[model samples]
Target: MTDHSLYVLLRKLEDAKIPFTLARDRPDTIRVTMHLVGERTEIDVFDDGHMEVSRFCGAEDIVGDEALVDRLIQENRD
Candidate 1:
């Protein structure tokens, strides 16, 4: 969570009714527990929602599109 990237992401998630947990105490961590894209997976929405918790060093390995991330985040919202 870098300067309201969390806020923006959170807004999206909350809008779509997606399930997510927010920990502002940790800037590098955003925890989300839910089934997304396919199977059950946990994702750590990072700056611009570019990180995934399921994969190791996912930032370098996995790339999450902004729109998809926004939509995904939104999906978990209310």
Candidate 2:
């Protein structure tokens, strides 16, 4: 994702009142964790503008470039 897109995503998450933690996983990757009811969804942003999301307790990894944070949040809501 581009910088603008990432910024917009972050703002949208904030505006939606989702609680999350942002951290640097490496020099080229930034990780964001959205805390849900019983599980946490993670978004990893790479330097090349790529992003992937995975649930903390999920058995499969969700990887893609499309913006899917909203859907992920909706799925884990209490």
Where is model 2 more than 4 Å wrong at Cα?
1-3, 58-78
lDDT (Cα) of model 1: 0.61
Clashes of each: 9, 1
Residues 1-78 of candidate 1 have per-residue lDDT tens digits of: 545555666677788887655544367677665434444445676656575656332233356678889999888997
lDDT of 2 by residue, 1-78 (tens): 545545766887899999989998689778888987668888887776688989876434557544587777788999
- Using alpha carbons, what is the TM-score of model 2? 0.62
lDDT for model 2: 0.79
Give the alpha-carbon lDDT of every model: 0.61, 0.79
Q: Give the TM-score (vs. native) of candidate 1.
A: 0.36
The candidate scoring highest on lDDT is 2
RMSD (Å) per prediction: 14.9, 13.9
